[model samples]
Target: MTKSLDAHYRAVVVGGGQAGLSASHYLQKLGIDHVVFEKNTVAHKWKNERWDAFCLVTPNWQCQLPDHAYDGTDPNGFMVKEEILAYVDRFVKKVNAPVFEGTSVTSLEKVGNLFRIQSSAGSVTADSVILATSLYSQPFVPRAGERLPEGITQIHTADYRNPAQLPEGAVIVVGSGQSGCQIAEDLHLAGRKVHMVTGNAPRCARFYRGRDVVDWLADVGQYDITIGHDGMAKKKHDTNHYLTGRDGGRDIDLRKFALEGMALYGRMTGVSNGKMLFQPDLKSNLDGADRVYNGINALIDRHIAEKGIDAPEGSPYVPLWEPEAETTELDLAAEGITSVIWATGFTPDWSYVGLPIFDGTGYPVQHRGVTGVEGVYVLGLPWLWTWGSGRFLSVGKDAHHVVDHLAAHLDRTRRPLKQMANG
Candidate 1:
């Protein structure tokens, strides 16, 4: 719903995703006057950017929005796409946020003491700004995809719906991140021939010991660990371990797929003539993924033993299949490959904000959600505060921290003015 836009506000939130809405909830709780500008409808990414079988990798219990947690019966289960949409919709209605849907903030700059925002809906001024855009807003397909035969139907996973959507033939799925692995499994399960280019992204067991790995990790306080932990800051940039929550949660084991006739390849190089090329790193990629998988399980084992928890025993993962021949090249036509799915993921684009707050990598320089520059705050970034900071579970916590700081800062500044006026 479009609301009446005013000339000025105490705070202005850019981007109306979970992060933005969470911040809006807190600001409203504190009686702060603000407007949330959403370029698209709320949860637009979830609505459009996902494949058909999309479900939460984390359990439904982790759907911790501000003032709302998952109240469904399937707390341990993952919420499917439809349920996820409904959840976000409920939050939008609950907040009754002061938002301008379809309003895009084209540019934002600090004008004197106020932040001036130019949006599709027009300009507005604010005392402070919350840049609440998601971590990855733009889908990235490599230029190498262009080198492929124009005959092959090419798509990024964001556009992928199901196996029925692709032409009937073998499909080459690139990248081994969450989407890549899951889509490959989806196609494979649908009896479509799948050839995957497995990247060095890690994998994890969906269930370890007697409970889901997520439950165990949460018990170990993993989600609460901040980004400042040793060797943890860099984890923000790491690829999430490949797993799936479809038809109940399960590990996405590429080796198991390979054993079941799914051809596995290494990183994609380029296409020449009709042949798809790859580096001869298939064996190493598989092993590296397994190491992370086993390592995580081992951590859980230690925690269980130390606490003497009576959980079912588990064993380390032994490779189900190994690649003896690393095929660095493949004749696409001979292999009957008719389509390519690039699950290469996304990159952040924040060119509109006329601020020197971003790092060389385009990440905003911020402590928690508060940016280095005064009056500028960023939210919903992965590892912004913790491992789950960008996730549904922890986004609310981060929002509270930032809004608390914002409120306190405003109050402290206001006290001086009141004192000066009275004096």
Candidate 2:
């Protein structure tokens, strides 16, 4: 039997990651009686989901939490997974956030004028609710994975720890995003044979013109640009380019992988009778990546010229690998490939919320975190307001905006009651 406890607050924030923590910071400043309910410990995903060698693609200075910023000596350095977790932990302590660790919100529904949140520990009612669970909630693997042989081992990027975790054999890493390329590099460096399925994602160097690409983007106001502005919405939905913050920061070009003896193929189409089928568009994929790469460099060059910034002329990026005619299908047994790593990506899951604010695709339909449902808001969704809205550098801004709207909503709704009581 489940026991119900009496609890109430002016606002309830679900999830205890950066988004939730940021929201809590603003709520504290606003003097809103609120509590953050986390499914596990604070920043659980950063602590567990990431691999041992994983580092943030963005630099340390970009880790701007609400009321807290990265003040470390290595501002340009990338933060390792543990470092990120520690930073979040420090922020939680600094703000003295009212977070209930280990508590999971099983369901949320609207009850009369209040939002009723049922959790494993108990229940809480709040005038407003902020769903800051973030976009990366569930690991997404393709349906073709089910067709692989029983002997083969499969792991998603979320569960992958290191090369040693996989079986000793040639490993096929599906998806050529940042995770896929980085994992392939790790496995190759560990002396394991690696085969990667390359996609059409772009690639960019860590630094250009004596400055990190992140710094250039930030200087040019790229991060501040919102989605739905021009063609940004389409760009936001595109697969991220191949890049890594490991070993300092570097580009994860397909050509580089090919030169390193990693067998590269086009996108994984399907699996049939223990054979993995791939499209023979390696050249096209490489070309697409090069286009985006050159485009970014061009933008940087233009920025330098227009601003008259004192920067050296960066060398033009050149592709090194030429495609050789390769077979489209690989016999798993014949090739000695024993494992598959799916670095595909993640999807958002909001089934726990019983609100009608979600779209047909299950994403919460909101305008800058303000849901159509009264007093219900969402945060940390990709492109919620801007390209960087969901990222750590900018989530604080989104949280502040949402909290301001929430406060206004409460004031408008509750002011009448206070006036009547005074009368």
Candidate 3:
């Protein structure tokens, strides 16, 4: 028989990164007796991420948890990994969020309305569990990746950190997403011949009103906008652009790397012997990206025109917007790209939760994160509600909203005082 563990709180939070920490912070404010279970140290993934010269795409001014700022000299600047880690550490201390570090929640199952969670440290019965782990839990290398010839070495972008870590031979980055592009650029700069496998070319803003695109988003309520599935799909289809470039006093573009002859390919299908190959439709993907960019520009113009908005006499004219199509698949072995980094995107996996309450997509079936499975909630999902809920720097606010909703639910549905005392 399993030993009965204490159930002192209504909720238990999983993970110790920004999402979990932020949830714990709000639970404290609401006087909820809660604890965070972290499989590793604070911001563990960030520490383990292969983020060489990586900086937050979101601006620093918007990157603070409630009741705490980064507390550094450059509060308005985007922070690197070190700065972010330090900030999270400080936030934990400041809020006094109850956390159990090194404690990993191994499994979770819904027993009636309550969730029985098993952890490496101990078992806990919580009325609810907040899964704050990021969607990037699983690095998705393509299926064909497994069949590569034994002679070549393969490393996902998740495993890539710096230029020196890569093999001396020519490198090919598989995905055209942010991670793939960044890694490709880094490898190329390190004096290694690099090939960027084209999946799809994304539209990137030239300048958002004479400032960084991130800055413009913040200014134009993009961060505040809550978009649902339709909105998110529209955004993705409409804006194929990925955020790139270092901050250049508010406006920096990374056209230099592209202009420097980064060898571009169509796409990778498979590998044979030791030779890597690529498809021939590489130009089509590039063209699709261009069309997307033009579409976004056109949309901006339409929005301005529809509003009959008057800009300053010297202001740049905004273009009308439209969305471009996706790209076709390509052959890999023919192009001789031995190494491939899968940067397609990320998805949330709640298999460990082991709860039947999850949707087909592994997301909790809820109205704004409150599932029928009592005492369970979720936060920090992309576009949680059409209003730009899960942006790079939007976790804190999302956590707060989730915590509030959970707190109210717990208060209204908590077991009676006498029943609690007997337990």
Candidate 2: regions farther than 4 A off = 1-5, 415-423
Question: Lowest lDDT 10-mer window, candidate 1?
Answer: 414-423
Candidate 3 local lDDT, 1-102, one digit each (tens):
113335655888887777787788777666677778877777777778757677665557766576675556765567776776677667767766577777
**Model 3 per-residue lDDT at 88:** 63
* Model 3 residue 26 lDDT score: 75
For residues 238-322, could you state the per-residue lDDT of candidate 2 as single tens digits? 7776788888998777787788888988888899998999998888888888888888888899899999999988866887988
Q: For each candidate, what TM-score against the reference?
A: 0.96, 0.93, 0.81
Residues 1-423 of candidate 1: C-alpha lDDT, one tens digit per residue = 546789988889998889999999888877888999988888788788888888999999999998889999999999999999999999989998888989888899988878899999999998889999977788899988888887899999999999999999999999999999999999999999999998889999999998999999999988888888888878778899899898899999998898899999989888788888999999999999999999999999999999999999899999989898999999988999999999999987697899889888877888898888787899998899998888899999989888887877677654311111110
Candidate 1 structure lDDT: 0.89
Clashing pairs in 2: none
Compare the candidates by lDDT and give the number of the best one: 1
RMSD of each: 3.5, 3.9, 5.9
User: What is candidate 3's CA lDDT for residue 327?
Assistant: 32
> Highest TM-score, which number?
1
Output the better candidate (2/3) by lDDT.
Answer: 2
Q: Give the TM-score of candidate 2.
A: 0.93
The superposed Cα distance between candidate 2 and the true structure at residue 105, in angstroms, equals 2.4
